[model samples]
Target: MLPGRTWTRLLVCLTCGGVACSDDSQGGHARAHYQETDHPVAGTLEPRSTWRWCYVHRRTV
Candidate 1:
């Protein structure tokens, strides 16, 4: 991957919302995948902080 191309993709991701993004620059060889959750999940105890809940996403590159 060239530095210029990488920077371009990064700029695009920043300009657009970073919550969800798709990367197909690898020409079917490599792709970026993301999963989003509406609310944070806690299996057991919940945090006492007011800003505890947040959106989360997992990506495979």
Candidate 2:
């Protein structure tokens, strides 16, 4: 990967013969993958004198 290079080709390079995304941008992917829905952040451990969690995962039980 090149410097300052995002996961553009990385997405399309996905093997397994699947419909990979060739989007070289950083929006839909973030919303689809890194968004706080599927792989949410862990909001359980206490922050270091910050009172804030890093990966704050808010889900309904």
TM-score list, all predictions: 0.16, 0.19
lDDT of 1 by residue, 1-61 (tens): 5444432122112222332212333321112311222332211122443221122433211
**For candidate 1, what is the TM-score?**
0.16
Clashing pairs in 2: 41-55, 42-55
Mark the 10 consecutive residues where model 1 has the least summed lDDT: 7-16
What C-alpha lDDT do the candidate models reach, one value each?
Answer: 0.24, 0.31
**Top-scoring candidate (lDDT):** 2
* Model 2 lDDT per residue over 22-52, tens place: 2345443423443434443221122342221
Which residue pairs in candidate 1 collide? none
Residue 46, candidate 1: C-alpha displacement in angstroms: 41
